[model samples]
Target chain A: MPGKSADKKPSFSDTFSVVGGNFDDAGRVSSRIKGILKKMCLPFEVIRKAAICTFEAEMNIVCYAQRGDITLSVDEDRIVIEVVDQGEGIPDIDLAMQAGYSTSTAKIREMGFGAGMGLMNIDRYADDFDITSEVGKGTKLVMIVNITEGS
Target chain B: MELGFIVKNLKLMVRSGSENLTVDVNGGYVGDLLSDVIANSKQGDIWITRQIHQNIVAVATLKDLAGIILVDNNEPARETLEKAIREMVPVMVSELPCFETAGRIYQLIAAREK
Candidate 1:
């Protein structure tokens, strides 16, 4: 009898480093990850959720941090994404998570990002989400999305 | 209704991405708040907004929107037009006010469903 592992797709991983304040390439990393997910033949909805979360994370880095790293790891049934950044972290996590609360400067707002929904959007799109930060230090987010049941 | 049909009926100016005029139109949602649009809009929906920034292209692309209609004569910044074309999302404009254009779009799609 074949083992359960044999029935699962092989695992894959990718990492991208995003520069903060780089508005031009804010969504570049997410776009690349989306392309990879498309090749994996994941369902449309799943890919879309992943893209939104990744894009939001990337934009957060661009808006507030000095730089960040995004990692995509897929193992059979689930896809996990982790983003870690270095910058001025949120002072009040609860307030920041509110739908419309924003600390974005006028410059970022003019470009259509930093609406204060980055964390919420990412949380909503991911099946499991976690965030931790230290003021003037950095922020990190981990988002896990199920791929097996998606269609 | 098809995107081309909507464009013709509304007499909107196709500012860019003319080649994407054929994208199938499913519905329309009007909003300028970026995060709200991202959370509330549906796939293949035609987004009506006053935001003419390039980041609009990223939002629309992630949502797989059919096209974008900017109201109140809000012309997109040059980079916005470039990104819209690169993403294959037609960006159109209307001299009409935001509410009026949204109303017309609602009627167009509602009539099609009937």
Candidate 2:
């Protein structure tokens, strides 16, 4: 298995900040993270999955939050991405998880986003996913992608 | 089929990454929704859309798409074109509507397959 030998400690880690309502630079952080992963020479599948999850998380922060931070840490066996945002948190996680349910405004839709599929896309790509939010506090997401098969 | 051929056959205006048009196009995907494109677009598939945002360039890069074709004469945002040039992802424009552009490209690829 690549990146897996004897140690399981993280070999690379980085955190990126996203400012809410900053549509001009929404996906820049995700692009940088993708570049980092590509340089690390991680498997193409792993890099693609991690990039998709992080991009969705970053978009959520840009669309809804006041500000947020995305942290990416890669170890021998897995890649972990955590996004924490200060925003108008989702009131109903179950409802929000449903595809095609969105609270986005006209401007967001005009930008070709906010079709209510971001969270679901992240879930579909991540090996393990966790989400928690408070009504007015913020939303937090943790997504992990395993490197080794069935590990 | 290669992206350059599509550009020539469709009479597309190359806006950025002109040198990168030789990339092979395995298929095509038409969608304006960013998430839909990101989730469903396959590698080497030329993406057809009406959106001209800089984010479209990001999606194209992330998905390893063959390139992006903007329909209805929609020009990309200035920053979008710059980013496309920098990332070496070809961006083209077509005067036709999204449906017609998609249909023509689909026919081209389908014909090549046979």
Highest TM-score against the true fold, candidate: 2
CAPRI-style grade of the A/B interface in model 2: medium
Name the regions of candidate 2 deviating beyond 4 angstroms: A1-8, A149-151
TM-score of candidate 1 versus the correct structure, residues matched by position: 0.91
In CAPRI terms, where does candidate 1 land?
A: medium
Least well predicted 10-residue stretch by lDDT in candidate 2 chain A: A1-10
Model 1, residue A46: distance off in Å is: 1.4
For residues B1-114, what per-residue lDDT tens digits would candidate 2 score against the true structure?
Answer: 888999999999999889889899979899999999998888899999999989999899888899999999999999898889998889999999999999999999899999
lDDT value, candidate 2, whole model = 0.91
Fnat of candidate 2: 0.68
- Chain A superposition TM-score, candidate 1: 0.91
